[model samples]
Structure formats: C-alpha cells, structure tokens
Target: MPSALLIIDMQVGLFHGPDKPHDGERVLGNIRRLIQQARERNVPIHAVRHTGPDGSPIAAGSPFWQLLPELELDGDIDILFNKTRPNAFHGTSLAQHLRSGGVDELLIVGMKTQYCIDSTCRAAADLGLKPLLVADAHTCMDTPVLAASAIIEHHNATLNGAFARIINTADIQF
Candidate 1:
C-alpha cells in the first residue's frame, strides 16, 4: 500500500512569537529529514493547516498560519487540507484525499500533542487508515503540572501500539 506523510499543524501560529513549545526547532530537523526521504522515494506528502474564527490564534492571515520555514515544502505537495476542528477529518477532505491518492498508511507528524496530533491519529484509525506517529517528531508546550518532555513521553508511551505506533524518524525505512 502506498503511504503518505501527513504533516499536520506546523503552521506559524504554533511556533512564532511568545515561548514556543517542546523544542519545535529541534524536532524540525527530523521532520525535514522525513520530507526529504519521502521525496526521494516518490511518496506523497500532504499538509494540514488549521484555521479558526476571528481573534483566534490561528486565524487566517496570521503569521502562525504559515508552515515553519525550516521544513521546506515545494509546490508539488500532494494535498493541502484546511481544517477548522481538532481532528483533521472533521469537515475536511482529508479522508477523500487519502483515499483518492490510494494511501493506506499515514506517517503523522505535527504540533499540540493533546489536540490536533492526538485527535488526528485516533480519527485516522477510525477511518481505517494505518497511522504511524513519529515519536520524537511531535511536541507541545510545558504545562504547569507536567514538563513538555514528560508530556511527550507520556503520550508516546500511552498511545504506542494503540492510538498509534511510536516510531522514531529513523525507523521510517520506507
């Protein structure tokens, strides 16, 4: 089955200004590597952007809506889906896009561990798409009760082999 990399919610809204979360810069290198590898192998790459109502952080035209510059995307992106909800599937064409592309497996990487990232993974499973999350590729801001690292570790451990498999970027041999 053909696989696609679902690069979700890497927009400027999540990374620019204020204190950023969980070393987004650090994990970006890994995301770039994955993009490069996928390109070389002719694998499709789809980008998901999140938008919200006025005054929302991810409102349209905000700097945060743009993807980070480090993980460069070319004009040849397989698909670009705009989502208003946490789950990428909610009112979006993501499922149809994947199905039309003949994509059976998905490599997920993005932001906000407890929100978009987590929700999308579960939704993909519900849609019968095999979702593989890059363990170290997604991160979140530090919370008062838990550090960012701990949150990431917990999500990986809790979600591994269930919500999704936790694989390092290096383990993606495809």
Candidate 2:
C-alpha cells in the first residue's frame, strides 16, 4: 500500500491557546503514536502549517505558526508545507509531492475538523487520493452552531464513505 501521513495544521496557535480544541490532549497523544508508527514503517510524513493574516494568532513566520514542540519531526524523515487556505492541496505542491511518492492513500490527522480536515479530505478524494481520517486524532473548538464534540461527530458521519474512510488511531495499521 502506498500511503502517506498528513499532519495538517497541528501548530502552536491552534493547540497552545487559551481556548483549546476538544480532546486536544488525547488527540495529541494519538497523533504522536501515529507519527511513530509511520516513521517506523518509513512512510512519508507531511507536516502542514496553516498561515494566518498579519497580527493573527497563526500569522506567517510567527512563533504561533510553528508546529508543536512535542512533535519533534526528524529533518530527514518529515516534509513541511505552509498553507494559507483551508484545504492542504490548495495552492500547495501537495498533490504533486504525493504523486511523486506514488501515494494512493492519505492518512489525515490534524486540527480544526470542520475547516482544514474536512476540506482536505474532500479535496483529496476529488483529486483521486483515498483519504483516511483519524477520527480521534482531529479536533476543533466549539462553534455557536455546535459543541466541539458534536462538530467532530457530524464530520465523522458526513465525511465517511463520500470523502474519506473514518478510522480510529488505535485501529490504524500504519
């Protein structure tokens, strides 16, 4: 199986803020375990950082835009990308890069389940890449429309089959 792991927007601004995403601590632990497995299998690991407008929390080149220190990416093992849009493939070399590696399937784990994670999954499917969303490893803050837990549930139900295969971190093989 040609697979790659996409760690989308797991940055300081999103995770280390005053108002945190739901189940963030547990999600981080899950993501950390996923990274370890991917590395052990020699799978490609792509770390994507989301860029914000000037003066915003995740502004480009700001400390907040940096990936979480807990990640500890190996220079030779991990690839990095900075995206200004919600979808990781938009205006990024992601598609071509994945193709170069002959990656037919993508394992996505990240922040903001509705925005980045949802968009990325749909877009990846549209581009003909199979997306596996780690249900327990992605999260978002509560919105006026729904609580954080509800949002996660909604996306998991909606994205499954149509855009991606929903899987749990513990059940992931690589």
The top-ranked prediction according to lDDT is 2
TM-score of 1: 0.93
Q: Can you write out model 1's per-residue Cα lDDT over 1-174, one digit (the tens) per residue? A: 789998888888686757687888778888889999998999988888888787887787677787777778865665766788889889988899889889989999988888888899999988998989999899888888999898888888887787787899988977
Clashing pairs in 1: 12-64, 13-64
Clash numbers, per candidate? 2, 0
Query: Model 2 over residues 48-148: C-alpha lDDT tens digits?
Result: 99998899988988999999989888767699989999999999999999999999999999889999999999999999999999999999998888999
Which pairs, if any, clash in model 2?
none
Kindly give the stretch of ten consecutive residues in candidate 1 with the minimal lDDT sum.
73-82
Backbone clashes, candidate 1: 2
Candidate 1 whole-model C-alpha lDDT, 0 to 1: 0.84
Best by TM-score: 2
